[model samples]
Target: MDHQLTQNLEEYSASSTTIKFDRPIPLLRAPSRPGLPMTLTGPYILAFKDLPSWAAAYKSCESKIIAQCEEGARIGCAITASNKCKPPWWQSLTGWKSMDLKERERCEDREMEDCLVSAKEKCMGFAKEHATTPFLDARIALGEGR
Candidate 1:
């Protein structure tokens, strides 16, 4: 057993409020197993103390969102099929004065801020709908450029 690895894992686990387990989480791994993926050779993470709660929370969060995520991902993929971040053709239209360009940029910034705020609020709303406690709230951090 790697004492350093166990100590590091313990240190990290201590910071999480949701999971509580024994001091030294018994780590187990087989060098090889039947039907195992070729890429999977790492130790299996096991924390039995509060597994039921964690599993239940994870399952609950996933159950309803399976279909929703699939559909949402499909729509999102379709919407961003051409993942180019280039400004719309209208933004590159005929020449304009500096003031006009600056004002347009300002308007665009405001619109982007508003959209980001609304998107985060909607994400939180969805989390709250399925979350019984703040600890159970699930969030996915999307890239700003995405």
Candidate 2:
């Protein structure tokens, strides 16, 4: 295994919290098997942890939104379909400006739910820009992003 290659590739995370493959390039190819795609989609959970209670998490996330607003930061929330690369396996904390604390919480929950259902479909728009095949599964281990 190319340690450097793995490191470089692993470092290449995508925003919108999805992980996909780019046409099975030799270095980036995902596992090849019949049920591989399903396995790749994974039980990777989109976790939102830390910040203690929901209220606290809400507040922390809200603070980010407020800070962004004050700084005139752009709020961006997108699925993989809209992105230009093969959908990434991760997403940064984004798109907080257009929502209030409650809205953020709701959106978070909704996105999590969406991840459970048709993740590829939900993120299809961004996927076009980032053409890819099914590879590794993505689990959003929260608490780390904050």
Candidate 3:
């Protein structure tokens, strides 16, 4: 059998739950600017050795970030579909069998970005307002600019 066919067969038999990514991708939202949103939804791997400091920072906030990313993906997917917007091509590529995969992924990525940006802003604002919470500080430490 051809490799693609074999891979497809393997995929079908595989447990979907077992195929987890290091990062649970957020859905991208459609662009209001009449084009694709910037960002893609895929398994984003962070090599601890490459950027240990950033990795540590992200680790500290992993739970929060993951939760937010998931929420963002949900919102983004819905909005993107409604707006009929797509995300950048560099993100995830859908198979030919799934005609809407491209657009859906695009939308999801956009939503995810939006959620991240919003979370960053909120954290920054709380940091400024409370001066003690450090919620924003934590996010900033993870490379989310204030």
What RMSD, rounded to one decimal, does every model reach? 17.5, 24.3, 23.5
Per-residue lDDT for 53-104 in model 2, tens only?
Answer: 3334444445554444433312232342223222233433453333355655
- Tens-place lDDT per residue, model 1, 1-146, is 69999887887784753667569854222122223332232333222224455556555665565546545644554344323333465655655423355655566556555555555556556655655343332222235695
Those runs of model 1 whose alpha carbons end farther than 4 Å from true positions after fitting are 1-48, 51-99, 130-146
TM-score of 3: 0.25
Ranking by TM-score: 1, 3, 2
Kindly give the number of clashing pairs for every candidate: 0, 16, 12
Off by over 4 Å in 2: 1-43, 46-52, 73-146
Alpha carbon lDDT of each predicted model: 0.48, 0.39, 0.48
TM for every model, in the order presented, reads 0.28, 0.18, 0.25
Largest lDDT belongs to which candidate?
3
Better candidate by lDDT, 1 or 3: 3
On TM-score, the stronger of 1 and 3 is 1
